[model samples]
Target: MDKRRTLTESALLLLVSLFVMISQGFAAQQVIYLLTAVFLMGIGFLLPKSVNWILILSTMPLCYWWPDIAYYLPPLLRILSMPTKRFEAATFFVYSATLLLLPLSAYQGIIVMLLAISLYLRQNDRAMTTLGQDFLASTDDHWEKQQQLALQNKQLLDSHETQLALQIAEERNRIARDIHDNVGHLLSRALLQIGALETINQEPVLEEPLAQLKQTVDTGMDHIRLSVHDLHADSLSFAEAFQNLLMIEHLCPVEIQGSLFTDLTDKQHNCLSMVIKEALTNTLKHSQATLLTFHFKTLPAFYRLQIRNNGIITNEQYPPKTGIGLQTIQQRIRLINGQVHIAQTDTHFQLTITIPKEPTK
Candidate 1:
């Protein structure tokens, strides 16, 4: 699965085949040991990389069986075919030197070769296993660090969102303060002027325009009052936010219908709440008919929210600019690495949102 490992495996398999061909009775007596090493490394036409060093070490026994050492002891040099490349001279020297302590014969040379190769192979095997264990431990540590990073990143984003929400709330309160200080008093004065004009200025043309102006001022007053009435609800928990969604049918014809397929988390509530508000607003403003629906479902990697309006869309410019409630909703979802998609057809308008429940988080 890893690129480096794959390449190494490929290379090792080729090397094993070469080793088997070259080792075929080149050393007539050491053939059994060479075959055993090759079989272990390339078992399923898929050699595990962990056995590379073992394969190389298995060839060491064949060195002493080469033809170069026949003159030193003519009687014991019959094993001239153990196929290998490294330390042929060294193996002969060590084996020959050891053989000098006793009678030099073919049978005795075989025993000497076996003893030295077995020791090196066993030591190499143990060392390889220990290195593999160290590699596994390091991998586990890296995985834990990545998880910690993801959690810290999630917390930082939530903190950022809380700060932004506070700022927006402060801006709303400031707007309300401005209305109370300047616009509210100005409208009061305009209402008094309109009252005075009703008594004194009786021209019919002037009267209708003045009445229209008063009506216009009254409309502005109503808008200011609505802006002052903040509609935001800080979700205390997942249950409260979900309950608020269910309660939307009272304010509009919202068919709040769907099973929470996945368990919802606290971070998702911010996005979900904003989505509910947008759906309700869209229903009231663009979708002229009844029966709007909110559906939520769980996915392995994301929590999905689908809002469908059964009402036909009439407003030509249905999708508003990233300015009002929808912008706030979009921003909230993206903070948690979520996505939003809007769709509209002849009879249905849907807003689908997917918030990540897993990684790349």
Candidate 2:
């Protein structure tokens, strides 16, 4: 029950009573009826919380000296007397009073019936409001549960991915070991046999073919050794690998800035290692660079690698040839959907690579 609304209704009832007093044929009791109605309105507005007490006293006047607008009395009285918290036995007593005293006329009867209907509808409205609040509370609980499930699912997926990566690394290490222990030993024996046969006297024609065969076999063995090293490359930490590349003998001084975080996958680590190795090789072999600089940085959405050298003294008099090392760097970057840019000026050469931290599938 709204206090303001109840007060407004009480005030309106007083106004109706004033209109009724003016229409009534009797003059002696009109002033008394008007005064009673005004007094009740004032009580309703000023002490809305105590309106029920006023209601008990109010009914005496309505039954004793029925006002011209007595039709308004029963509804107003019923509203005030009814329990605000919940329905109670007191409601039936108010209902009985309303039925017994309500003005018996088609017009007044119809008005009384409408007032009852209005009260009934307002009760229904309050019930619906309570239900709506409960529904919203239930919806909030459901949304929280969904969020918890999503977080749990993500954790499970990350754990699975970590296990898969460990298994792959183990498998790669096993393969590298097998290749080194078995294939490497076999190649060494073949080389020893070839050397022993070389010392034996042979025709000049046979000697030439045997030397060519030995060269081919040595080249194949070198390729196999390189493959085995690559297979085990994933075991090396990024920092260790980068430092090893820097420690290699070079004509120029190498400077490093920033560092990479350890949240990268094995494939990313391997690719980055190869890029640094190839870039440094180019600097040592081709650039007469006196100073080499390597810069690494991680951003919110991307990781950047930059390598620059001030060794290329030659200005771009003509196009610089793109070598296999540079080509390999580009291919590795492409595999991760990264971008690589190269810049060469009269005194310096720079390679910049940027890879998104989370690559889109």
Which residue segments of model 2 deviate by more than 4 Å? 1-119, 233-361
Q: Candidate 2's residue-wise lDDT over 318-352, tens digit each?
A: 23445545666776677667889989888888999
Candidate 1 residue lDDT tens string, 55-89? 33443343345322222221121112122323334
lDDT of 1 at 273: 63
- Candidate 1 Cα errors over 4 Å, as ranges: 1-110, 200-209, 230-361
Give the Cα lDDT of each candidate: 0.55, 0.65
Note the residue pairs that clash in candidate 2: 289-311
Best by lDDT: 2
Clashing pairs in 1: 26-81, 27-81, 27-82
User: How displaced is residue 262 in candidate 1, in Å?
Assistant: 34
